[model samples]
Target: MHMTDVLAAADISKAVAAFAAADSFNHKQFFVMCGLKAKSKDDMKKVFHILDKDQSGFIEQEELCLILKGFTPEGRNLSDKETTALLAAGDKDGDGKIGIDEFVTLVSES
Candidate 1:
């Protein structure tokens, strides 16, 4: 399975705005640095699911900070401003949150 398969199980393109947390996503590193070995798409999705804390099928801003925690050695969350950029970096729909597709594509492409 791939990240696409995992995200495909979710609803597509639901507009959600705002995420709450404070840290940064280092563009220098790989997306799987977020606790995902993610050589395969399914692996990426698993990481996505792990980040989607509310289980709303969307990885909200707060959740994204938590995800960033794993990506860092200090296990620190992202700053709210930085988190917004992370969302914007891949939020193709401008929903303010990272949907499955956005996340999968972001990681897969990288």
Candidate 2:
């Protein structure tokens, strides 16, 4: 179903407020919530490109850490330990980095 179909006009304010208050918003959740996937893969691709700061095909340690900063309400950065753990969880290829495929896989499954 479309996002609009799922969300009433009256519920929009609350949904947006909740989204804004969230510490972190993942791609799959976003796509599903906004019905972007129902439209096309382009939205996901755009989000990925935006997160890929250096335009590198892969997301490296620093990039992940930088992004994690937005994952907390306090604007706190991810510690090295936290970053490593995140990598361990998301880097499926053992390549020490997260590729687009891995990224999509992580979010889609979550």
Evaluate all candidate structures by whole-model CA lDDT and list the values in order. 0.56, 0.55
| TM-score of model 2 vs. true structure | 0.57
Off by over 4 Å in 2: 1-41, 69-74
Indicate the residue-level lDDT of 65 in model 2: 68
Model 1 residue 91 CA deviation (Å) reads 0.8
lDDT of 2 by residue, 1-110 (tens): 22234334344333333345334434345445544344434544554555577889877898876543322223334567656766676799899998887766655664
Backbone clash count for every predicted candidate, in the order shown:
9, 0
* CA RMSD (A), model 1: 10.0
lDDT of 1 by residue, 46-86 (tens): 76776676778888777876653433223456677676767
In candidate 1, residue 3 scores what lDDT?
A: 34
User: What is candidate 2's local distance difference test score?
Assistant: 0.55
Q: Model 1, which residues run further than 4 Å from truth?
A: 1-24, 32-38, 70-74
Best by TM-score: 1
Q: What lDDT does candidate 1 reach at residue 67?
A: 57
